[model samples]
Structures are given as structure tokens and as C-alpha cells.
Target: MKRTLSLILLTIALGACSTQKPANDPALVGTWKGLRTQTDKCQFLSWTTHLKPDGRFTITFFRDVQQTQAIQTEQGTWSAVNGKNELRTDGVRMPDVYTYQLVDADTVRYVSVAAGPSGDCQEDYAFTERRLR
Candidate 1:
């Protein structure tokens, strides 16, 4: 009876481990673009991001003026953390971490929280439209 109880307990433990969430696929390996929306001002911002296979990424922010002119652009690199669910950008003026969720094979959504010059700023969660080569 003792041996049987031990076997059942071990089996249950192993089963629980097997039910763990699978690791995210490394298919997040390309460039993506999206319309950035500012939560505070309710304005639309343009942005682009490139995810490399070497666990590195680059992002660019653009501003559209009068629906025709490109007014500004900011570029930076990204490093992945927390099993690729979080990323930190290099040289970003804001001190915050961006959390990501894979939407599909080619798309992802990222949310960023930071302290703006005036107060706390949180970006509306935005979907990244994947760019396929």
C-alpha cells in the first residue's frame, strides 16, 4: 500500500509539470509596423519595429504632419527578458519596460508604461502589423 501511494503521488506531480505552458516560438523574427496611439492626448503616432533572430530588436517612432509630412523619427534597440514577454529599449528617454504578447504567427501587441515629463504616461496597447520579406 505504501509503494502504491508513492507511485500515484509521483505520477500526479509529473502530470502537472507536463501541463505547463509551452515556450513561445522564435518566429518573432521580422520587422513590424503599427500606428502608435497616445493615451493622454488621443493622438495617432507612427512607429516601426524590427525583431532579429539574435534576440535583438530595433524600433523607430515617426510623426505625421498634416497627413503628408514626416516630422520626426526616434530609433532604438530592444532586448528581450522574462521569456520574451518583456523588452527594454536602449537609449530610450522613458524609463520603463515594454510587455509583449504574441497575437499570432506574425503579429504582436506591446504595452508600455512610463513617467512622462508631466506625470505618468501609459501607451494604449497597440498591435504590430508584421512585415514579411
Candidate 2:
């Protein structure tokens, strides 16, 4: 009887040590810098966005070589849907639903998946973002 109890205790300890908490989407309440590496003219475009917990975000696209000038700025509300696998932005021109993939707590990739007319084409805008802090 003692040997059986010891075996059960050992099994329980081993199981506890082998398990880990599952990873989930990180909080979006921070600053993120993103860049698009591919464009039609092969020019690089970068943007910095600040997201607040109140569901508001402000994104400014860089337009200068020094990254000091902004060509445009977008302010809107953003939310994650489909169990945080997708991001929906409202109040932005050309609002798109993107494939939101979080690699870790500090990294994410956004891919535009909206199809064009007839569903034969889709915008290939893809960008990866890193947390500022």
C-alpha cells in the first residue's frame, strides 16, 4: 500500500512539472511600431500607433527619411474578433479586417485578407509590429 501511494504522488508531481500555461493574445494597451516591407514601388512605409484600453487608437504614417514627418494620421476604435484572431478597425478609410496573429507578447503580424472584386485579387499589404515597451 505504501508503494502504490508513493507511485501516485510521483506521477502527480511529474505531471505538474511538465505542464505549462497556454499562451493567449496579449493586451493591446500600448504603443506599437509597424512597417510594411513590400509595396508596389518597393518603398518602405512605417507607422506608429498608440492604443488605449478605452478602445481608441491613433496611427500616424511616416513620410520622411528620418521618420519625423507624417503623411497622414488615422484615429479610430479597434477591436479583436474571432477569438482575437482578427482585428476590426472603424472610422478609418478603407477599413479592413486583417489576419491578426500574435507571435508573442511583444510581436504581431497583420495581413490584409479582404478580397477584391470577383474574389480573384486581394491586397497583399502585410506588416509586423513590435511593442514599444
Candidate 3:
């Protein structure tokens, strides 16, 4: 009887544990665009993040406002943290951590942390519109 009771308790605990959903997959697997806004400055930038199934990612940033002008572009490795909700970019010269929240399948919000000449600067409360390929 004691063994059966223990088994039942263990089963209950396992069931409860299994009920906890895994963190949402990092959804930055496609092109994203947003109006890059800073203190009194705003421009349009396009971003592309590719997430491989093998836990690797690549990110690209491009300036899109200038159709005739040469686009400023950069690319680097990326990783998802905090259950694929937060993204960290590697090999960038500025602030590298981005907190990404998916508003929908076609939209995501991100906060970029950057360094300024005076001190550390943070760009928060920003939104990105997903670009359909």
C-alpha cells in the first residue's frame, strides 16, 4: 500500500511538472523592419534574423530608407536567452542585448541597449514590424 501511494504521488508530481509549457521559441526567424528612432532622430531600418534548428542564428541589419543610396548593412551571430524571448547579438561594437517580445506572428517589439559617448544608453519601448519574404 505504501509503495502504491508513493507511485501515485510521484505520478502526480510528474504530471504537474509536465504541465509547465516550455518557453516560446525565439520568433525572430525572418525579416523585420522598424523605424529606428533615437533622441530627435528617426530612420527606417530593416533587420533579418535567421534561426537555425540547430540552435544557431544569424542577424542582419540594413538601412532601407535610402532606395538609391547604398544600404548600410551588418551581420553577426545571434543567440536566444530566457526561453528564446531575449536575443543577444555577438560581434557587435555597441550594446548587444535585445529584449524581444512577440506581439503577433508578424510583429515584435525589441529594446536595444547601446553605449553613448557620454555614458551607457538604452533604447527601450521600440516596436518592429515583420517583413514578409
Candidate 4:
């Protein structure tokens, strides 16, 4: 019986080690505004991206630093990848994969990796963002 109990405890310990840390469910169903560091020409873009719970997203770019003048807009969908550590976006001009981490309750840092068709062009962008609402 003692041997059986030890085996059971060992199994339980191994199972515990395989579990992941639980986190509060973060909802991206709102607008997020931030500075996106671009690498194509090395510039910062003022952006407001909208997200929905249904995985739909819209990105708006601003020409002014104050984020008042709208320059362009694009729509896409976002999905979680690599066990939620990364985000994959589709239906956009840049179709990118972004790896991100939460810095705090209201902030997150994201790194997006992009590649061109010829396979010779690749770029990465780092974005510092805050939840707006």
C-alpha cells in the first residue's frame, strides 16, 4: 500500500508540473492605442486598433503624432498561436505574426515579424500599447 501511495503521489506531482500558470482572461474587445515602431524605414506610427471578441479587428493609422488625423484603415482577424504567447493576423496588407507579453494591467509589449513574398525581405516591429476602455 505504501508503494502504491508513493506512485500516486509521484503521478500527481508530475501532472502538477505539466500544468500552466493560470491568468485572468483578458478581453481584447475594445480599442487599443499605442506607438508602433516600424522597421521598414525606421519610424514610429500612431495607431488605434479595434478588436472584437469574435476575432475581428480593425486598424487605423494616424498621420499626426497627436493621433487626430486619420490616414488609412485596414481590417483583419486575430487568433492566438503557440499556446497564446503569439498572435496571428490575417486579411490585411501585412498579414503578420506578433509575439507579445503583458507588461501590466493596462499595457503590453508586442513584437511582430513580417516577411515578403520573395523571401529576401523580412522585418520586425516592436509596439508599446495600452488598452483604451
The reply for model 2, stretches above 4 Å from the true place, is 1-26, 38-42, 64-66, 83-94, 115-122
Candidate 3's TM-score reads 0.50
Question: Could you estimate the TM-score for every candidate?
Answer: 0.52, 0.62, 0.50, 0.61
* Per-residue accuracy of model 4 over 7-107 as CA lDDT, tens digit each: 99999999998885454234445788986554565555688887666667787888667988887786766665442432334442445656677777677
lDDT of 3 by residue, 39-95 (tens): 444455445555554445555556554323434444444555552343334454443
Worst 10 residues of 1 by lDDT: 113-122
The TM-score-based order of candidates, best leading, equals 2, 4, 1, 3
Which lDDT tens digits does candidate 1 get at residues 19-123? 875543366667766775566565666656677765566656566522344544434444554424434445555544556667777776666644333223355
Q: For model 3, what is the error of residue 125's alpha carbon versus the real structure, in angstroms, after optimal superposition?
A: 6.1
**List of clashing residue pairs for candidate 3:** none
lDDT of each: 0.57, 0.65, 0.54, 0.63
Whose TM-score is higher: candidate 2's or candidate 4's? 2
Question: Which model is ahead, 2 or 4, in terms of lDDT?
Answer: 2
lDDT of 2 by residue, 35-76 (tens): 666455656667888877666678788865456978777676
Residue 112's lDDT within candidate 2 is 71
